[model samples]
Target: MGAEVITVSTDTQFVHLAWHRDEKMLEKVRYPMGADPTGDVSMLFGVYDENTGLDLRGTFIINPQGTILNSEVNFYNMGRNIDELMRKFKANLHLSKHENEGCPAKWKEEGDKTLKPSPDLVGRVYEALQ
Candidate 1:
């Protein structure tokens, strides 16, 4: 899980990017992420809160071709769901490998049957929820 971590700050004139050779901060992260001073990337993603001048603490799953597959920017009283994010990533990757279907809400791998997007199916799901 040697994923790269980066932060966007509006303090310096340029972006900041650094790494931690030591793995003291978190597990599975041998290197710590760096930050960009200007926060260009954050601005582009609309995660840069102008009032606070800080990123909204979001995560993005980008594909190999540099396409953003999923993104969410939320800070106050909200945080990204690790399990859902991982599930989405895995589902997308699986779709790339095989001709599978999408994931429904609270969907776990081989967990439950997914409903298709249709009027009848929607009514059934609504009834089930009720």
Candidate 2:
């Protein structure tokens, strides 16, 4: 929750400002909106479509140490799920604190059971999950 959230677009700074000023659009968005008119950042993230000259939906979760924990890119028409992003962020935070355990599918909270990597877990993953 302490992490900084930034949205980068291929639009110019003026366009970003206009959008922020639009009450019907982004009036309540207090986070920084980066304007990448040249698509430099989008290109760097491989979200820029060369043919369309538009950036696909790209979301990156970077840690405080500048390490990217998660990267997801989707088509322009597809929208992102903030709830899933928050879930992954929490899971990453948990993994950072507990290096020995692995968060399994559908793991939601800190108290959720984690998997310990071992030879026994290889063939009995369904059993261990139970």
TM-score per candidate, in order? 0.63, 0.89
Task: State, as a TM-score between 0 and 1, how close model 2 is to the true structure.
Answer: 0.89
The per-candidate count of clashes, in order, stands at 5, 0
User: For model 1, which pairs clash?
Assistant: 15-37, 16-35, 16-36, 16-37, 18-34
For residue 124, give model 2's deviation from the true position in Å.
2.3
Instruction: Indicate which candidate wins on TM-score.
Output: 2
Residue by residue across 26-101, what tens digits does model 1's lDDT show? 4454343446556787788878877877777777877777788778777756866778877877665654555444
In model 2, where is the ten-residue run with the lowest total lDDT? Answer: 19-28
Against the reference, the lDDT scores of all candidates come to 0.61, 0.88
| lDDT score at residue 108, model 1, on the 0-100 scale | 61
